[model samples]
Target: MRYLSLSLVVVVLVATIGLGWVFDFVYQQYSDPKQSPSEDKIEYAEILTKKMAVALSSSNNANAFITAWQANDGYSLQIDSINSLALPAPLLSDLRLGKSLNIESDSDLNIHYAIPNSSDVLILQIPYTIEDNKKFINRYWVTSLFYLLLIVLFLLWAKPLISRLINLRETAKAFGKGELSQRITVGKVSYISDLESEFNHMAQRIEDLVSDVKLLSTAVSHDLRTPLARIRMGLDTLSEEEEPAQRRVYEKRINAHIDDMVELVETLLAYARLDQSMLAIEKTSIDLFALTEKIIKNKQKERPAEHDKSILLEADASLAHCFAVGDNTYLKMLVNNLLLNAIQHSKTTVLVKICCRPNSLVLVVEDDGDGIPEDIKVDLFKPFVRSKANKNKGHGVGLAICKRIVQWHQGSITVEKSEQLKGAKFIVNLPSVEN
Candidate 1:
C-alpha cells in the first residue's frame, strides 16, 4: 500500500476502536437495573399491597380496598394492564406481602392485575436485555462499517496521486545533486500540477546556467588566444641588431602578456570544472611527505636561487610513510602552487612542515615575509583576484587553483598566522588513508 492508503487505514482502525469503546460504555449504562423503570414499578406495587391489606382487614368492601390502594404514594393504576390480567407471579407475591420486587420488560406492553381477596396490583416488566443489545448493534456498528469501507475505497482510488508525489520527490533529489536534465512527469494529475510547473522552471534555469558557462568559456578561449599568438609572432620577428635595452624591454613585456593570457585560460578552465560530474578522480594511497619533498625538489630545479635561499622542508621522517587517498597528479599540482606562492612572498626563510594528526594529514607552509593584508585575505581564493602587493609578481590564479584542487580531493586549505614564524601560514588538511 502507498503511504496515503496506510495513513487512511490507520485512521479508520482508530475510529473503529473508538466506536467499540463508546458502544461498550453505552451498553454498560443501559444494562444497569437502577436506570430502568422496572425497579420503580416493583416499589409502587409493594406500597399498594400494604394499603390494600389494611383496607381488607378493616372489613371494608373490594371497592374500599381498591380506593385505599389507589390512595398510596407514587402508585398509578393503568387500565390496559388491569384489564389484560397478565401480571407475573413474583410481582403478585411482592404486592400481597407489601415487599419490593425487581422486574424487566422487553416489549412495549405491560401487565397489572389484582390478587385474590386483596386490592394489591402486580406489575410485570418483561425482559428487554436481548433487544437492548440489538439496538446498540443496529444504531452504531452498521453506520460505522459503512463509513470505514468508504474511507478504504477512497484511499485505494488515490494510488496514482501517491505515486506522482513519490516521483516528484525523487526527481527533486536528482536535480539537487547536479542532474540538470531530471524532470518530473506526472501525466494529467492536476493536484501536483503546480509542483511540476515549479520543478520544470528550476530545471530550465539550471540548464541555462550550464549552457551559458560553456559558451562563455569557449568564446573567451578563442578570442584571447588570437592576441597572445600574434604577440608571440611579433616577438619572434624582432631583428637581432635592435637596441639591446629596447629589445630586452620588449621581451619582458611580451613574456608578461603571454603569462597573463595563460593564467586567465587556466583559471577559467578550473572554474568550469568545479562540478564533480565534470572530472573523474582516480584515488590511490600516496605518501604525502614524499609527495611534498618531490614537489619541493622540482621547484628548486625550476627556481634554484629562490629554493636555495628561502625554502626549508621540516617534516617528520616517520611521516614520510604516511599516505592519503587522492589523485597524485592533482595532489602534486596543489602542493606546487602553494610552495610557489610562498617562495614568491617570503623574504628570507620559507618553512614547509608536514605532520600527521588523528584522522587527517596536515601540511603547513609558512613564509617569513610580509604577510597578506587583512583587507585582501578574504578574496584570496577568488578567481582572477589579485592583491596590490603581488600584482607585479605573477597572476593570482595560484591560490584559486590550489583551492579547487583541495576541494576536489575532499580536503581543505586555509591561511592563518604561523605561531613559530613571523609570516603567513597556509595549512592543507587531507583525509588520512593510513587510519
Candidate 2:
C-alpha cells in the first residue's frame, strides 16, 4: 500500500509540472510575436540618425546639440569627408540616394553606420555584441528528451506492477475454475503484496471448508447406517408383537435407536458451529484453575457408579489465578472436553494440572490407561477420527472441538505420552494476559 501511494505522488507531480510547462509554451507562440535583437537595434539606429539630421538641419543649434550629445550618449559620432575615403560602389550609390548604411566588421569591434550630409558623411558607432544568447536546457530538442526520460522511468516502474496484476488475475481465474489449491505468489517489495496475502488467506479458508464438507458427507453416510438398521429391526419386531408389555418394550428399543441418531446429528452440528463461532466469540479474562476445579467436580458428580476412575486437578496455590483472555463459555467447554476424554479413556485415574510457563499458562490432562496408539495419535484432533478400541462408542469430535477452541484463543495444543502416568497426555498452553 505504501508503495502504491508513493507512486501516485510521483505521477501527479511529474504530470502537473509537464502539463503546465507545455501549456505555457503553446500559449507563448500565439499570444506574442517576437523580433530579433538585430532588427530592433537597426530600428533604434534609424531613429537616432533621423533625429540628428533634423537637429543638424538648423544651423543655429547644430554645433550645440552635437556637442551636448557627444558628452552624454554612449556612441562615437563624427563628420568625415566622403570624397577623401575610397568606398564600395554599391554602398556609395545607396548612400548618395539618401539611404543609411550599416557596416559590420569581422573582428566584432564596433557597428559603424554612415549617412550622407552634403559633401561629408555622419558616422555613428556602437559595440557589435549579440544579445540573444540563451542556454540549451529547456529549448526544443532538450524538452523532448526530458519527456522521453519521463516515459522511460514510468515504464521501468510500471513493468513490475503490470506483471503482478497479471499474475493476480490469472490466479483468481484458476481458483474460480475449481482450482481451490491455487494461490498467488509475490515478492516482499511487491506493489500489491497485501492484496496477494489476503487472496491466499481467503483461498486457504475456502479449501479447508470444502475439505471439511467432504469429510462430513462421508462420515454421515457411513455412521448413520447401523442406527438406521437397528431402528428398522425394532420397528419390525414392534409390528409383530401383540401383548401390550411386549409392544412397549420393542417401541422403547426403537426410540433408543432414534435417540442415537439424533445425538449423532447434533454432535455433527456442534462441530460445524465451532467453525463459525470463531467470528463471534466474546472474550474476557478467565482464571483457568478455578474454572477447571468446577469442571472436575461436576464430572465427578456426573460419572456413573460403575465407573471408578477419579478426576483430580493439581496446581500450585500461588499460581491458582492463571488468567487467560478468551471466551468464558468456549474456555469452559475446552476444559470439559479434555477432562471428559481423559476420564473415558483412563482405567484408574484422570489427572488435570494447571501450571505457568514463561509467556503462557499450561493446562494438561492425562489418563492412567494404555498410552495412545501411535497410528491414531497424529490425526487425533481431526473430526470423525476414532481409535480402534473406541471405534463403536462416541462421535469422535470432542478432541476436535478442543483443538478449535484452543486455536481461537491464539493458543496451542499437543498430545504426548505422559512420563509420570505412562498414559496419553494432552497439553494446552493459553496465552496469559496482564491484569
Candidate 3:
C-alpha cells in the first residue's frame, strides 16, 4: 500500500507541475503586456500620452512640462529631431499623421507623439523593472506548493482504500486455491463495496453448484446400481428358463431395465451439459404461439398410446404472432418438458396458453390433476427432486433441465397452483422481439 501510494503521488505531482507550466505559458501568451495589456492600464497610458502631447504642442509651457513629466510618476521626457529617434518608418508615418504611440520594453514603457507644426518628437518614459514582478512569481511558487500539499493529503486519505483492495485480492486468491468458503465482508463504506458484494454472490453460487454436483454424482451411482442388478438377475433367469413364456418374461424385464438406465443417463447428460461453460446456442425470432400449438398437436397424437387414456390437450393462443427471442432447440425442450409433465399427471384435460405482453411472451401449461405438495414445490426444479405424489418415479432431472434452459435464454419460470384448471401450473416467460 505504501509503495502504491508513493508511486501514484509522484505521478500526480509530475502531471500537476506540467499542467501548471502549460497554463502559465498560455496565460503569458494571451495576456502579454506588449500585445494586449489590461484595459485600465492601456487607458491610463493613452491619457498620459495625450496630456504630454498637448503640453509639448504649446511652446510657452514646453520647458515646464518637460521638467514636470520627469519628476512626476516616474516619467521621463525627451525632445529630439525626428531623424535622431531612429523609429520604424511605419511608426514615423503614424506620428506624422498625428497618431500617438505606446511601446513596451522588458521593464519599461515609451510613449511618443510628434509635436504639431514642428520637426521635434516628444517622448514620455515609464519605469517597470524586473523587480516589479517578484510578487507574482512568489505567488506562483505558493500555488505550486499548495497543489503539492493537496496531492499528498489525498494520497494519505486513500490509504484505507488501498488496504481494502488488498484484502479483497487476498480473499479472491484464497478462493481460487480451493477455499470455497472465503468471502469479502466489506460493506457500503468502502469504495468497491458493490464489487465486493457481487463477488460474494458469485462465490455463494459456485459453492452451491459444487454441492449440487456432488449430490448428483451420489444420486446417479445409487440409482444406476439398482437397474444394473436387476438386469443381471434377468440375464441369469433367462439362461435357466426353458419354457418360451417364461423366457419372454425375462426378456421384457431386461429390456425395461435397459430402458430405465438409458432414460436416467440421458437426463444426467442433459443436466451436466447445462453446467458446462460453453454451450453453443443461437437465438432467433420464433413465433411462440405457433410453436406451442404445434407441440400440443403432436402431444395429442401420442397421448393415447403413452397414457392408455384419452386426454384433451387444448392450446389457446391469445395473439396471431407471439414472437420471442430464444434458441429454437431450447425452446422446444422447455415446452416439451413442461407439456409432458402436465400430460403425464393430468386426469382428463391439459391446457396450454400463450400470450404476448408489452416486452415478453408468457407460456402457461396446466393440468387438471392433483396440485403439487407445498413442501416440494419450492425445490421442484432442483436436480433429483421428485414429489411422492408423482407415482411414475421419474428421475426428477427434467424440470431442472428446463430451468437451466430458461436461465440460459435470460428468462424465468415458476410453478404455482392453477387457478383455471385447479391443478399444478407452470408459467414460463421469455423476452419478446419487437414487432
- List lDDT for all candidates, in order: 0.67, 0.77, 0.78
TM-score for each candidate, following the candidate numbering: 0.47, 0.63, 0.60
What is candidate 3's lDDT per residue for 184-233, written digit by digit as tens? 99664566676787798788668768867986988788889999999999
* lDDT, model 2: 0.77
RMSD of 2: 12.6
Over the stretch 140-231, how does candidate 2's per-residue lDDT look in tens digits? Answer: 55567667767776787789899999999999999999999999876977888888988997887687678778878878998899899999
RMSD of 1: 15.1
Pick by TM-score: 1 or 2, better one? 2
> What does candidate 1's lDDT look like per residue over 1-435, in tens digits?
244456567656665676657666776675555554545744665565445444444564655444555654434332223234455776556545655344334443233344445454444333345555676566576667657765775576567677888888898898889888998774763456666777886686477456646655664776577658867675875555388887887787778778767766775676566544327878888887788888887888888656455677887655755787788888888788888888887778889999887777888999987887887788677554566666555545678777767776768999988777788899999987663
The lowest-lDDT stretch of 10 consecutive residues in candidate 1 is 74-83
Q: Least accurate stretch of 10 residues (summed lDDT) in model 3?
A: 307-316
Q: After the best TM-score superposition of candidate 1, give how far the Cα of residue 21 lies from its true spot, in angstroms.
A: 17
Error of 3 at 104 (Å): 20
Q: Roughly what TM-score does model 1 have, to 2 decimal places?
A: 0.47
By lDDT, who's the top model here? 3
Ranking by TM-score: 2, 3, 1
